[model samples]
Structure formats: C-alpha cells, structure tokens
Target: MVEGYAVGIDLGTTNSAIAAVTGDEPEIIPNSDGDRTTPSVVMIDENDETVVGQPAANQAVSKAARTVQHIKRHMGDDDYAVEIDDEQYRPEQVSALILSRLLADAEAYLGRDVDSAVITVPAYFGDAERQATRSAGEIAGIDVEHVMTEPTAACLAYGLQETGDADTSESHEKRHVFVYDLGGGTFDATLVEIDLEHNHIEVKNTDGNRRLGGEDWTQRIVDHLAEIAKEEGDVEIAGDPEQEQRLYDAAVRAKHDLSSREQTEVTVPYLGPNYNLETTLTRETLQELTADLLDQTIDEVDELFERSEHAIEEVDEVLLIGGATRMAQVQETVESYFGMEPLRSINPDEAVALGAATQAELMSASGDTTADDVLPGEEEDLLLVDVTPQPIGIELHDGDFAPVVEQDEKVPISRSDDRFTTVMDDQTGVRFPIYQGQAEEAEDNTKLGEMVLSGIPKAPAGEPTLEINFEVQSDGTLEASATHFESGESVDTTIESGVRLSEKEIEQMREALPTLKDRAVAGAEQKEA
Candidate 1:
C-alpha cells in the first residue's frame, strides 16, 4: 500500500469536497467544520488577511467588497479577477485558497501527507478552463494527476457503488446512461456507456452551458426582488453592493426553501425609509421564471442525442446530478422529457468527490506505483475513455477555423497531417494560433494561446509545406505542433488557457499561506465570539 493517500477533489463553482479511498470504500473527508461540502468562497478581511470557504461566505453579507464567489465562471477569461482591497486577484488564486483549505482538512482527517489528487471539472470545459483548474491545484500545493470530468466521476461513483441486485450484477449487459449534471454554477449533460462486465466507462458525448446553473436560478429570484423594491419602495437595492449580497443570500435560502416547500418569503431590511423588502415567491413562479434555463439544458441534451444519432428510448437510464437537481420542477421536467425516471440513488454533491477518490486509487495502483505494491482491492480492471468537449484547430489563411480535431472525439488523442502553406514566397517562419470552439470563424472561437514555428525552409508560396498537429491529453490539455516537411524539424507548444502563474508566483503564494491561515483562524474566532 502507498504511504500517502492520493486524494480526489471536486473543486466546484459553489461548493467543494475531498475524498479518499479506504480499503474498498470511498468516502468524503469532511472539512474542519464537519460539513460534507465547503462553500467555494474567499474573502479578504478588514485586516487584509485571506479567509476561505464558509467563513468567507458568512463574511460576504457585511463585507461584500472583499468577498469572492462564483469565480469558477471566469476561469478561462483572462480579464476576470476579484478586486479585493484595491488589488486584483486571479480566479486561480482565490480557488487555490479554497483548495488549500480542503488539503488541510484532509491531512487532519487522515493524519498523513496528501500530495497527489485527481480533480474533477465540467466535461464541457475547454482547454483554458482545464488548465486553469490544474493551476489552481498547483497553487494549493497539489500534484494534480488528472482532471476528470464531473459526469465521468459521477458515473464512476455510480458504477463502483452498485448494489448486489441481479440487474446490476457482473453478468449484466452493458448499459447506456445520460447524466444531466446541473451544479451550482455550471451544467453538463453527458451520454455515457458503461460496460460493467468489462469494467469500462466511456463518454459518448457531452454538452453544457458553462455560465448556467442553479446560481442563475437564484440570481433570477434576486433580480425579481430588486425589481419589486424598485417599483414598490422606489429604492435601488440592487445598486448597492452590500444590499445586493444580502438579497442574494436571502434568494439562496428562498431557493432552497422552495425546493421542499411550495412558497418561501425573502425579506431584506434597510431598503428605504419606512419600507422593507419582504416578498413571497412560490415554487411555481420560480420555475416559471427559470423555465428557459431548464429548456436550455434540454436543448443541449437534445443536441447531443442528435449528434450521436441516439433516440431518447435508447437511453437505459438518466442520472440527475448537482444540488440543483433536488428541485421538483427540475426532476419533473427531466422525467417528462426523457420518458423515464432519473436515478436518485447517488448523492449529487458527494458523488464527484467519491468517484474522484476511486479514480485516485486506480491511478495510484496503475500509474508509477507498481501493481504488486498496491492493496488487493485497490487495483481494478476498469477502463475510462473520455472525449474532448470542443473542436480544436488553427487559423487558416482565409481567416477561417481549420479543425484538426473535432468535438466528442475520444481524448488522450492525437491528430496531424492537416497541411498549410505560406501566403508569401520565402516565408521562413509561421505562427499558429490555436483555438477551441465550434465557431466557423477563428475570431469567434476562444484563442487558447499561440505557437511560433521558426526556421521553416524558404520556398515559394503554396510550395512550402507545414503540417499542424493537435494532441489532446486525457485531461483536456492541448499540445499543438508544427512540422516542416523539407527540414524534418518539429516544434510543439502547449495551448495555455489563461494567465498561468509562474514558479515565482507560486512561491509568493506559498509564502503568504501562513498569513492566510492566521486570518482564517482569526475570522473563525471572531465569528464564534
């Protein structure tokens, strides 16, 4: 057995969790607060010290300017940052703070050093988003072994935790499942094929809206209350940062309440003189307001089914994931559309973390660590094959996207021989701008990064041959290369998704870790006081 445990982390947009494999079972390692999940929030206290998770979330109401939430939405966007105390901090930095907390909690629980992990991300996340996730893990002092997709992790959890029922027995035939994952901040729908007999889990197709999820639904309620405040009391509640945060917090509570109760009240004080915003929002109204969001998810699922030539009838089962799936409307709408009941056995919040632990065990036993040294049950015969969620290509001479690898293609894959020639004679150098998306125009797609290939043989236009190659690693990282046919020379570069921190920056963050911890301790003490 390995001396140190390789943890599995579900670094989510709204909440995060960590887990580890114990013997043959995988269980969540609760945080110091004893909660199964930790809020993905960070705050810079009045003392300019960093506080993360639930503490930061609690501080958000009174200290809205210093708090950061939903930073996962801005993962790949280089322009996005959380401005705290007049300084801009990148999303990865804030996320690293959260990861650091999880690591600390895990170490406390297991009484060992935890260094390696398999972090889960949205299946539809592009190259930049995946890389950003890895960087976040790095900042947290983790060797992120793999970036598993959320749906895949959920599916893994489902498969490994199977009951002894004959229907799911070892002799049972292969099954196809549709995983509809609507998390707090991101939504992913993946079509997966599971062969229990062979222990193979393959992702057939995936689609999602990176910006849409349960948070948007809650935001809709918050916006509704703001409009009510405007019309009834002539107060601009939304315009104030503190008031907006309070309303959002209230909206979250109301959203949760509506899931179990038909109606809930959202009351926020100090809106205007002689006026307080107190309103009741029925579950029906909440569903009505966010009907389009649900429809949008369905559209993506339908798009996947269409692309894969799959009919709804062919789906053996549909699994609902993410905390948002707890809503009655979400369940009812999905059941009605799929013509089948969605699986509810798995815990949406913990499944990703649990699956990650199982994957961690698998990786530890099979990779680097020898199979003989692993525990008896640690090594499984399972095979996981995932796919890229978007097309990867380079800019063509006509300003069009020349796709070298299409979306939904199996990952850990490499594609090459897509040839391109220089526009002018004696062109000795070529710049390949790598992009990810389905847009026909290169400008419309996301430019992950650029690669410059020099020393190309000078030849007439249309005569010099330069072949571009795109290799997507299993974790969704893209490695693009340019090969010169005549010179037999090749240069390759990784397509970085966003502004990755340098080693020096990582060291700087490390130096600040103790201070951040002190601040969190102080914040907790103050909160308790």
Candidate 2:
C-alpha cells in the first residue's frame, strides 16, 4: 500500500517543479538545493553514475555527449533514444530519473513517503505522449492519479487563488480565458471558460506545435553567435558538441539577461587557446532574430480561436502560463492580437504545479469520482472538464479515415461505430489500425497503434457486423473493443504503441530505482567533494 498525501508535478522540458497542498493552500516544494525549480537535465559522470538537476546542467559543457536535456520533447517518439556510455536510455527512463529527484526532495521536506502524484503535460499532447508520461511516473514508483493538461492546471490555480476564500453561494462573474503557453520545448494555445460562481472550468479548444518553443528561439541566437565565432576567431563551434553546449549555455544566459536589459554581452571562453568569442545581444536584436518564432505562437492562438466558438473579443481574460511568455516580443504580439493585456497575478513558472497540487487535493477528497461528477459545495470544490486534443479513428477500406472521437470532444467518453463489416468471406479476424489526426487519408495521420479482433465466426463478405468501440479516459488514455452483432462475442483491445515501453520494461525500470537512487546520491556527493 502507498503512503503519504498525493502531490502535483509539473514535469517541464527545461525545468521541473513539485508542489503539495498544505491545508487549504498549495505550496511549491523546493528541491534539496533549496530551489523552487530544478533543471530537467541529467548527466553520466566518469564513474558511470547518474547525476540530475543543477549539477548535471552545470557540467553539460564538459560532458555534452553524456548530458541529456529537453527529453520531454522526445516523449513517445519511437526512434528517439539518448545513448550514454554505449547504453541506450528511453525517453521515459530519463524522465523517471528527473521525477525521482523531485520526489526525493519532496519526501525529505515533508518527512514522509510520497507515493502518488498528478502530473501535468502540454494541452495538445495525444494519447502516446500522455501514456509515456504515465509510464515515467510508474517507473518512478508513484501512482499517477491523473495526467492533467498544463493550461487547465493554470486555470485551476488562477481561479482558486482569486476565489479560494470567497462565498460559494454568491454568484461570481464568468470569464472566458485564453491561455497562451510558450514553454521551453512546447507551446499550447488553449481557450478555457472559468465559472467561479459555479465552480467549473472547461477547455473550449486547444491547438499547438509540440516541436516549437523557446528552445527554437535560443537555437536562432546560438546559430548567430556560432557564425560570428567562425568568421572572427576562425573557431569551429558547429559539429563540436562541447563547444556547442558551451555556446548554448551562454546563449541562454544572454536570452534571460536581454529579457530585462536592453543589451547583454555573451562570452564563450576557452573555445581555442587564446581565443574567446564575445558578442553583444540587444533586446531588439533578440526580438528581430526570433520574430518568426513568436509569430508562430500567435498563429496557433489565431487557429485556436478559429476552431472555438468564443472569439478573441469574447475572452474576458488572457493568461500567460509558461516562462517563455516573459519575452517582450511575446507580450507585444499577444497584446496586439487580443487587444488586452494578459493577467499576471500568478507566477507563470509555478502555476501549473500549484494547480496540479490543487487537483490532487480534490481527487483525494472525492475518491474515484469523475470530473463531471464533482459538484460545488465548498470553495475548493470545482469541476475541470477537459477534451481530446486530436481526433482518433480507424482506417476505412478505401484508405480514408473514419473518426469515432472528434477533436475537442469532451473526454471520459465512449463512442462506438457499427459500420464496419467483413470484406473477405470466412474472415476470422479484423485488424483495426487506430490513428490520431484530422487528415482525410489514413496514411497522412499518425498511426497510434492497431488492435485485431479475432475469433469472428466464419461468414460471407458483408454478412458479419462488427461494432468497434473507443473509450477515452479523463487522462487521455484510449481503449478499444469490438463486438460481433450476431454471436454476442466481444474482444477487448490492447494497443501496442511503437513508441511506448512495455509493461515488463516499466517493471524492470521500477525495480532498478533503488540502485539508480544510490548512484545519484553518490554522484552528487562526488561532485560536492
């Protein structure tokens, strides 16, 4: 049996945070380093021991090849793996190490074991991505009570912070909020409706590019500096991982400094003997270099509103929910497009984790209750209604797509399609290739996995009727089943995702946690010594 209270985790790409609900309030749990946020970086030292967080991040320049950063972007990718010391680690495995570090700190702070948590992810993530995140939690020895969206979590924190002590019986103003989340490695534009009076929050629509974020902007700066280095110092920074990492660190510092100052100097030292590349980056130059990237986020916001029933004018408040939204260019563009300044009462970097903690509290109180079943009685009682980020369906005979669950559809839902029939006589099985996308052609969309319903009675073509059902949980996990009309035979589905780890592998990683934890502690001690 698990012990201790459930906590909330914001497993970010660049930085991760953990929070726990204390009495009626949620508080961010600082790591062992006494920091609210920990860098989502991991490195393997010369001793072949694992090191995580700030120490790992600090050594990236010297151990570039052994360092793993921004592993969140590769979650659920089949071909993506980080190789260190000739050993390959899956994305979830790397993510688990980070989660382990966060939980370890939380356990030490609370003086108790933490076995359950609610993790947040990008609002636009699909089933595979959500599954990978859950797998990471399992591997870290935590029961992932729920996998909530980042935008929704932000709204929860905002709403609770504003009305936590207010009377629930009184009527409050209803507001439509637009959440523009530009994080380290992913972006999401979500339109949410917050009814504090009714204690309800619903996600109306969401869209984003998972591959685009602040890192892309940083890369633009890195490229500019690299070009200058080669031209002036005749030093080759490109294709050299160590030099590239050094420049990346410098570029990130310059990016943050430029956020507040008009200009900041960036210097990459020891690139070569008696050579140091120095450059001055101005705020205007940073804006100019990353204008297109900023525009891409605005484009996603426009697309989000286009697909939503509420327009920009209908949005009563706009909330910026990620650290990347601190950029002046991002603020200017968002203000210009929405004609309103975004609300900044809540801390952007900490909102998601705080909200996740609030969610864990609610889930703990209302055991096994679904989101829709949550009612407003106390000030803390609120319903969070989320939706499927993408359409999921099966491939038809002509290679066209047939959607069973459309995009933006409210989740914790089940839908069935009985239009499928046997194409060949005496067919004992029917293979259903599941896909997630809005493409008209099956091949154009992302194939999530496949489920074959076997044991169908032999019959002539078109004689056997099959009813395929799809059920999407609140956490965005998908399960399927097929029922034969005449025989009353049913076969449940188990989607074999190419990018996800198997149950056996997850258990193996879970079993190895103690050994890894010891190594991490030893590595940290070694670094300090």
Candidate 3:
C-alpha cells in the first residue's frame, strides 16, 4: 500500500520540500531535522566529508571555494560542476543529495516507501535540464513519474479544490492565464488555458532565462553594499575573505527586509568597527538594482501577449509563483505589466509542491503508479498541446540558416527540408549545431545540441540530396529523422547533451546520499546469501 503512494516535490535552488495528498489536502512532510525546506547549499570540507543543508550554508560565508550555490542554474549542463578539493560534482549530483533528503523525509513520514513522485521544474528548462532533474530522481531511489512545468503546477494549485466562482460550473468558460515564476535562482513565464474541459489546461507558450532571478538581485545588492563599504567606511577589503562573507549575508538580509517594510537599516561592522555604517535600503533601491530582471520578465510577458489574439483584459488570471514574488515591488511590477492585479492568496513557495501533489493524487486514483503519469508530447481532445521551444533547422548555401520548424510551432508538427551539398563530391559527415532563440547567425543563439548526418557517398558538387525532417510532439522533446534523400536512408535519434558524471564521481555521490541505498541493498543481499 505504501508503494502506491505518490509524492510531490519542489526542488528549488535555495531550498527543497515534498508533500502528498495521502490525507485531506496536500501536506508538507516535515523532515527529521524539523525543517520542511532543506537548504540547497552543499559544501565539501577539507576532511572530504560532504556537508549539506544549513550546515553547508553556514560555511558558505567563509569557505566560498569549497561550497556550491545557485547550482540550479546549471542543472542540465554537461560542462558545469563544482570543483572543490580537486574533485568535481555535477549539478545532478548536487541536486540528488537534496532529493535524497526529501525522499528520506517523505518515506519516514509516509509510514512506508514512497515509490513514485511528480517533480516540478522551471517551464523554460531545456531538454537537458529537464532530463537532469529526472536523473536526480533516479539517483534518489524515486521513480519520477512526471516532470511538471512550474507554471502548470502553479495553476493547478491556484485553482485546485478551490476553483472559485470565476472558474466553476456556471463560469467554466475557457480563459487564458499567465504564470510568472521568479524563484531564488531562475525565472519562467508561461501562457496556459484554464477551461477544465478541453485541453484541461492547454499550455500555449513559454519563455524565460535560466540565469536571471532572485539570487542575481541579491548579488546586485551585495555589489552595491561593497561599493558603499569602500566609500563610506574607508574600508579597502576587496580580497578580505571575512569581509566578503559579511557583505554577502548582509546584502541577502537587506533584500529580504525590503520585501515587506518601506526601508531596512543594515549594519556592516566588518567594514569598520562603530566605523559601523547604517545604510537604509528602500523598495526604490531594490527596484533600481533589479531593474534588468524586471525588464526581462516584462519583455517575455509582452511577447506572449503580443502573439495572442485575445485582448489584454480577457486573460482570466495572472498567477505569481516562487518565493521571490513575496516582494511587494515584484507584485507591483507584475501588476503594472499585465494591467491586472494578480492573486496572492496561494503561498508561492508551496503552490508548486501542492500542485504536484494534486497531480500525484489524480495519477494514483487512475491506478497509474509509474513516473510520467502526465502524458508527454502532443495530445488531442484531452491532451495538452505544447510547441517546440526553439527553432530546428540546417544551414543552406551562402551560409543562410534555413529553419525547418519555427519556434513554438504547434505540437505534433512535422516538416521536411532539403540540404544540398555545398562542396564538390562531398562524401563525409554533416555538422550542424541545433539552435534556439530568434537569431540570424548561429553565434547569437543558444546552442541546444548538434546534428551530424554521416556516410554521404561522394557525388558531383552540390549533387547530394539530404532530406531532414523535424518532428516536435506535445511534450516539447525534439526528434529528427534525416534521409540521404539520395539513398532513402534515415536515422531517428534524440540528441541531448547532459552533464555527465564519471563512475568515480558517481561513486562519490552515492557515498553522500542521505540514506545509503547501496548499503541497504548489500545488506539485503547478505541476508539472502
């Protein structure tokens, strides 16, 4: 019976938590540490003992080199990792430790093993990032059934069980909704439908930068404080390790304080003693420091709205998700951007987790206990249709980029384009970089992956016929089938480069799991032996 349980998890950059609808409403399972959200910080001390959660954060101020923070940004990166004590830790591994803690806490509370869960990720997360998140679940002994979009999950939480008169029987008309998620480390903006019937909640479009979010705002505030420390306190402690720690913490607290009250007075004694400087940071200061993030979010929202056929006021709701939205300035900025006041009744930090739980409940009730309970790729009638987040294509003659499938092209879309040989008797492999973003040159866009069409037989210059077909289904995953149209041969391969962990690195991570899964397995083996 416990194996039938489905857990909902929100693995954030700053913290992580889990919940499930085993009882009435979804409830967050408290960890043995007496904390619901464990800090997402990790440290590798000189002793090589892995330090996690609050203990890791404690050393962050002093041992910056040995600790990793804001790692959620590099979730799917195959190249990025934390190098401490001459060892590297992948983003998935760092996140796995966080998941390990969540899994242990959920099992400890659920009275039996929690075999499956629906984990939430940023809507703008790329294929690699999404896959990396699923990989973390795998390492944690959890069968990830679905990786729910942050916005979709937020919408479910916003209206689940509490669908008000705005979206009830009499008022169950299809309406558009926007989700703006500004978490500690990243932002995601999504366009969805709220009709309960057709498409249930159709996802129209999504856009956001994985690198911009609340942590960047905090860093900006810290930069300003450092400048003030030098100017006002006559302190020249640029490389002073102790001074750096003091400044980072001071700035973070200042940002948190400015979210509610009008102004916050911060003291930086490390700058000097009673040389003690008290700086008053106002909401205006925060807005000024975080202007770029605000502008970027607004630009993304504006683009979505611009592409819509519906009027501005017709949108049913503007839902805000993520702890950063607690900032009054953030709400005001969103309100101004959308021309409508957004709802805040739901706790941003808990909304996504609660939605994940609701989905888990739906899946369990349906007798679907596997991960990916939520159908992926394009579906019809009851299916939620999603478009390709990027443009897929190959280069043409004269170095022109020919788009095979436009970005946001509707789900279940397929098209074939021809690529001719540019050089005479070219009988080799084809090399092309997969691109995302609207840019004319490959250098300006985000490289998603690479494609190589090989085994082309030598032919007269510009004589080889290459047919490339791109098919992007509802789930937003991309697959391509290319033919030597000349030879009528094709290969269907899903190419996504992910941050890889060597066996040695993976062995180190296993040793760091909150619960020793291998040891437990070995013990069972010994008992059988």
Candidate 4:
C-alpha cells in the first residue's frame, strides 16, 4: 500500500473540487476559505503575482483584463492564449494554477503532503484535450495517476455506494445506466452498464459537445440584458470590458436565482454615476432563451442511444452529474426525454470528484496499478472499462480520413492498419497526419499530431506496404507508430497535441509553481491583515 494520500480532483470549467478517502468513504476537502468548491478563476494582482479562486473571482469586475475564467473551453486549442501584462499564458498554465491552488488547500486541510491524484475530464474530450489536461497536472507539480472520464467517475460513485448498502442477494442483477453530465463548459451523454455482483462497469457509448454547458446559458442571459440595457437606458455595455464583466456576474447570479425561483431581477449598477440597468428575468424566459442549447444536449442523447447496443427503455437508471443539472429546464428536459426522473442521490456538484477519490483509494490500497488490474479492497475487486469517445485516423493521399480506432471502442487497446502505401515512386519517407473526428475529409477533422517514417527503400508508388499502429492507454492518451514491411524499418512516437507546452516549458513552469503559490498565499494573508 502507498504511504501517502492520493486524492480525486474534479478540475471543472467554472469551479474545482478535491476529495480523499477518509476512513472508509470518500469526503470532500474544503479550501482555505472553507468552501466545498472553489471558483475556477485566476488573476494577476497589482504586484504581478498570481491569485486564484474566490479572491481572484472577486477581481473579475474590477480588473476584467487581468482575470481569466472558463479556461476549460480552450484546453486543446493551440491558438488561444490569455495576455496579461505583456505575458502570454496558455490555457494549460492557467488551469495548472487552479490545480495548484486546490492542492495547496488540500494540504493545509489534511496537514500532510498529497502523493498523487486521479483527475476527471469530460468523456467526449479527444486525445488532444485529454493530453492537455495531463500537462496541466504536470505543470501543477502533481502526479496524475490517471485521467478518468467524468461520466465513468460519476457511475463509479453511484454504483459502489449503492452496492455497499445493497443486500447481497439483490445485488446480482445487471443494470444499464445513462449518465447525463452538463457542467459549466461541456456536456457529455454516456451509456454505461454495471453489474455490482460482479464488480464490473463498462461504458457502452459516449457522445457530447465540448463547448456546450451552463456558461452558454449564462451568455444568453448576458446578451439579453445587454440588448435591453442598450434599448432602455441607452447605455452601451457591449464593448467595454468592465461593464461586460459586471453584466456577466449579474447574469450568473440571476441564473442561480432562477434555478429555485420563478423569476429573478438583475441589477447592474455603476454602469454610470446616475445610470443603473435593472431588468426582470423569468425561469420560463430563461428556458426559452436557451432552448436550443437544451435541444443540443438532447440531440447528443439521441445520438448516444442510436449508436449504443442498448435501448432507452433498457436503461434502469439515469444519473445527473454537474452543478448545471440543478436548473429546472435541464432537469425537466432530461426527465421528459428519458421518461423518468433522473437520480441525484449523490451531490451533483461533488459526484465526479467523489468517484475519482474512490478510484484513487482503490489504487492506493492495492498499490500503484492500472485500471485493468483488479485491486483487492475491503469489499470486492472492481474492474472499470472505458471507451474512446472519438475516432482517430490518418489522412490519406486523397485527403480522406482512414480511421484506425473507431469511436466507442474499448480502451487499453491496440490496433494496426496495413493498407497504407507509398504515395510516390522512390519516396524515401512519408509523414502521416493524424486526426480525431467523425468527418469524412481529413481537413474537416481535428488534427492531433503527425508521425513521420523515413528510410524506406526505393519503390514504385503503392509498392511499399506501410503499417500504422495506434495504442490507447486506459487514461485515453495515444501513442502511434509506423513500419515499412519491405525494409523492416520502424518508428514510433507518443502523439503530442499541437502547440501545447514543450518539455522544457513544462519543466520551467513546474519549477516556478512554488514561488507563484507562495506569492498567492502572501497576497491572501495581506488581504486578511
């Protein structure tokens, strides 16, 4: 067994939380502010130091240009970066700062150093996004033992807890579960099968939009209020960063209010000395504004059911995960679409982190091990099987995509394709551009990375047999290799997503973390003083 503590983290789009196994059950570790969840916001203070969480979130209205929120949407985007004080901060770097803050808070609460963690990500995230998340953990100076999918984690949290309390005689029945997870910046619909008596959980199929989530709902409100303000008060709130930030905050508050109230009023003051923008928003109106977004999630659910082997009626349970599930519109839509009320036995805000903590505990108790290994626990051995959410392929000479690994395929798998050949006569080398998507054309898919194989013997076009292999680990990262059958030459590489931090940059950022953390702590202390 490991000597140190390993925790589970939900590195969410709008908020983040950490959990650890205490005694026999997983429990959330509160931050220094005694909050169960910390806002996923970061800021550069006046002193040129980093600050995170609520303190940083407080500055969004006052210092809009220096503060960044919702960085998760840009996880795998190579072209996006936040510029603060002439310094460029990549999405991973900003996310790392948030992770570091969570870890520091956990350490302070536990009074011990954390050894490692299992971080959760959206199941539909492709290889590039998953790799970027792992990189964020590295930059945060934490050993990311695994990157479990959010839906799978939610199911684990639910299945294990239910089994722990169930009668042994009644636990033998196999059940199908549909996990509907809508967080701040992403949505995932997953079909899962579980047999508690056998301690088995398998993801049958998964689909989602990485860009659709609660924030989009909030943006709808923001746009509505901005347009109303322009029309009623003749105040321009669109282009001004500070005013936009104020309106955003107000919109978020109104959204939360409408979750439990019939109607809520948003009042954004200080737009001008004598001008105050005030408007009333109803839950019905909010639903009307974001109806298309809700439909998008339902569309994903429809696609999931269509692709999976199980039918909608076969699902015995529907589990709702993420804070956004609290909205009445989301709950109503899900219940209506599934023809049954979704279960929320566990706190939607903490289910993913709790499930991750459960997995981490299993790993620590059994010694460091992979998901395939059945770690002996107090009760029984648990086996989790996850699948790839998107198809991975190589671009052919005709600009078509040839998929090597199809979506919904089981993970910790390896497959090879030998249909590729030399495109030109006497071609000594070939570069294969890899992509991830369902698109027929290579240009339409997302390019993950490229692998080059050289030193091929001179041959006529289509004469050389070239084999390409893809191996996906349990955590969803990809490694690829190519071989020339005639020359018996081979080359392999772990796919590096485009424009992410380099090894040198990661190391540099890791080294700078402690100082950045200290400065943040000092700043907090100064504020309290």
lDDT of 1 by residue, 81-166 (tens): 77766777777778888888888889888988786999999999888788888888888889888989999999888776553343
Candidate 2 is scored at a TM of 0.90
Q: Give the per-residue Cα lDDT of candidate 2 at 88.
A: 80
Q: List model 3 lDDT by residue over 294-365, tens digit each.
A: 888888777767776555677778888888887887899889877889987877888888888867766664
Q: State the local distance difference test value for candidate 1.
A: 0.83
Show model 2 residue runs off by greater than 4 Å: 1-3, 164-171, 365-380, 397-400, 418-428, 439-445, 454-467, 483-490, 494-503, 512-529
lDDT of each model, Cα atoms only? Answer: 0.83, 0.84, 0.71, 0.86
Measured against the true structure, the TM-scores of the candidates, in listed sequence, are 0.92, 0.90, 0.85, 0.92
Model 1 poorest 10 in a row by lDDT: 370-379
Error of 3 at 129 (Å): 1.6
Superposed Cα deviation of residue 449, candidate 4 (Å): 2.5
How displaced is residue 386 in candidate 3, in Å?
3.2
Give the Cα RMSD of candidate 2: 3.5
User: Ranking by TM-score, best first?
Assistant: 4, 1, 2, 3
